[model samples]
Target: MVPVNPDVTRFLHDGRLLAMPRRWEHRRVVARWLAHATLPDLLEPLGERELTDRLSELAADPVGARRAMVDLGAVHRTRDGAEYWRTELTEYDELVPDDAVEDATTSEGLHRTLHLDGRRIESVATFYDELDRVFMAGEDRRLRPGLDALDDLLRGGFGAAHGADRVTVVWHAFDRSRDALGFAATREHYLAMLADPRFDAALFRGRLADLEAGRGPTYAELVLEVFADHPGVELLLR
Candidate 1:
């Protein structure tokens, strides 16, 4: 079931209507609540244009709502701005202040995770916090610095140091971002890609560039480089 505060929903018409509330406090609550309401529809990757169009369909001010999603860490986009994913916050039920989340997301403690490989990710909790800032609720050119950090980390391998369970957590978050931003991948294809012996961050970025340049490979083409084989890949585009 979708989670939304009943009282807060009323301010925004049960999440069906949009109102830019006059009060800062009201705006904050409603925007967060709307982010919650946006979950079900965001089950797949969407480009920047696509996401905004969807948001515009419902809200009077689509830009504000879209920005709210990023600002609140409710959604994450790839560093290239080519894809986005909804984050599954472990503590989604908790009542965290918006200010607190903002403060936490921007705090610097991850400078050390860079330039290491064949080692367990030293700071798991810290990694995800920063990861969300860049992926789930990030915006502006502000994303580049974090993206560079991510590339350096991924150059070794995503969740590589962590193994399947840990990879699964961050990967699931990343996978969801793909749903919103990257091309579509079925559960089978996605899991296969995750379980594959190797994942190339460089290759991943190349595909992103292709996506942005209008000459990108289809998801089927992506599966080839990312995995040994994905059956019915041919049927994916038809």
Candidate 2:
């Protein structure tokens, strides 16, 4: 299947970018498309001059394009800026389903099940709402969605007297959820954190930098990592 560039063709004519996008979100999408179009192979690193020359084909300002790509977390370069490559991202375009079989029992039937509907999780805000419905059901403690909060919840503090000995989280329509929570969403999530004084500005700033440089994990991956850290938590992506 031919991969489609997301809403960026409007800025192009005869395969050349007409102009830079004014909106930051539009700029991020355009820059991300530029990085993918120019650097299809993540393993192959291009020299500074070579990369600029390739980017020059798309935009008048190759240097600016490079900067935008770096700023959007589409590409990365060495400290000396001698070499450049595309930042790695989870490909939602083609999702290969997970084949791991669930364990049938959890030691004398202490198994509990939770349902996470990915279709309802369109944004970080909605993601939290769904979490509240599933994990905080019948509990008065409402959680503000954040990684730390999520981590604490995974430790079984959501009105639970004790953490479940074994539990399985069946994430329905997992691909759709992953698509909704992809690069753009994760970038914006961190960007919001960076602006909010309530969050750890320093931590979020570093995370944003890493994300823009493609050195950081996506929000979904971060959540998975949190779940992985706690034993007896099984996630089944469907």
TM-scores for the candidates: 0.34, 0.53
Q: What is candidate 1's lDDT per residue for 76-128, written digit by digit as tens? A: 66666665545433323332222212111111111111111112212332333
C-alpha lDDT (0 to 100) for residue 32 of candidate 2: 71
Worst 10 residues of 2 by lDDT: 93-102
Each candidate's clash count = 15, 1
Q: For residues 219-238, could you state the per-residue lDDT of candidate 2 as single tens digits?
A: 88888888889766766676
**Cα lDDT computed for each candidate against the true fold:** 0.43, 0.71
Tell me how candidate 2 scores on lDDT. 0.71
True-vs-predicted CA distance for residue 197, candidate 1, Å:
41
